[model samples]
Target: MAVSARRGAPLTLEEISSVALRLIDEGGMEGLSMRKLAAELNVNPMSLYHHVASKEALIGLICATAAHHVQLPPDDGSPWQEQLRELALAYYRHVRAHQSLWTYLQNHPEAVADRQMSIWQALYRILRLAGVPESELRRTSDVLHAFVTGFVVAETRGHLPDDPDEISRDFDTAIRLIIHGLAGFSS
Candidate 1:
């Protein structure tokens, strides 16, 4: 059995977030609770309150942490289409890896409304490269985000074919369609 935290040791938000994220990953959002987190940490439930105000707040913290883990393609002057494909694939993998959290995020737009998020920034950059005007940047990115997210959601929910190779081929086709569609945009 793992040893509990010593009475003198103070719990950190990192520790709390780590354990909470693990709980979320293992059992989805429904499985995580302050009590469960405390039990996992070997601390009093009240101790969690010292780090996060409530379950919602803790979830928010966990989401932010998860967002940071998403691998965004660097602005390496690559072709916009390639960059966009990389971005889409990275985002897809990230969300699929955390499906429960993605479901929560879909239901709660505010959770992902931060335009400064790297995912948003990467999308906006790719849109600009694709010649999307500043005025249309938000709208264009929103559409693309929706498309990729919706695709992965469907794939994860068993709505798509079961073969991994078939899924990849379908996704590539989808990306080509998106890029071809974006070709019509003008600055």
Candidate 2:
């Protein structure tokens, strides 16, 4: 973690991602550019290429770094329904906290699949444990993921209740509904 004298320190991948995340937070996905990031880091634009191959790669890195902050609920023999609720709430909080990055990642599902494989796998396992048939697991996962993401997006954007408690209540209601729906399809 030695700081370089140039630009107050040489850029590390972690630093790059941090600055990029900030850029995204402040300016939205369209605002982040290699030149802008390099300027922010006090380095030549080309220097960014040494760390990241392209803007898309940098975005993936930013998303992956953000994903690391999301805490997946542990499988501790809890009821599958409770476990899924925990997972959905955790994911909702994470996306709400990083709305811009999450929104950007939405357009690039392949990148998300590549970088956030662990999170995806965890969600898949939870759905399987809830007795989602093998044939329906993928669809169920997609539906649940979309629902959680869409709910948070709406809440964060003020489309939902302004009160935190109300939002939480609504979120819980939605989760229970989805879980109940899944129960109907479970073998």
Candidate 3:
């Protein structure tokens, strides 16, 4: 929709997020500013403030919106290793699909806590199920998260081959190794 079309309509948080995400996609984080977003939305710059308190708040909203797409594995009777693999792959696909959002999150780790909590919880649960001690839960979760994030970032940046089949194989292999290592921590 053109900016003029939205001139008089009340702006929704969803719209703001959509446009903001688009801006980031098109021009990276530097491209997203209150003025640009307002211009894109056909509203005054101040109007954006009505929906999002500040640029940082808008980034948080965008990250949360993107995080909504990263589904966690089901809590059924699946093996903990399998569950961890599914969660990591799901997270990898989501981050790979939204590279800009991933980069933004990487640069601003503080902005993603609210949205990242669910994913962390799922990982933590799987680790706990695998017999990870309470003393090592946080460390284990961080290690798993670091591996997934680092691998996906590298793969998306073409440091890894562009072949999906190859990437999938590599990802599974790495996940299995990580899972196996975690198994050592089980009581």
Query: Mind giving the per-residue lDDT tens digits that candidate 1 earns over 76-129?
Result: 999998998998888878876788888888999876677887778888988999
Ranking by TM-score: 1, 3, 2
Q: Where is the poorest 10-residue window by lDDT in model 1?
A: 1-10
Best candidate according to TM-score: 1
lDDT of 3 by residue, 145-175 (tens): 7888788878878898889899998898889
**Which rank order by lDDT, best down to worst?**
1, 3, 2
Which prediction has the highest lDDT against the true structure?
Answer: 1
Q: Candidate 2, 167: how far from true, in Å?
A: 1.0
Better of 1 and 2 by lDDT: 1
Please state every model's RMSD to the true fold in angstroms.
3.2, 2.7, 3.2
Write the residue-wise lDDT of candidate 2 on 58-112 in tens digits: 8888878877767888879888888888888878887777778878777777767
lDDT of 3 at 53: 81
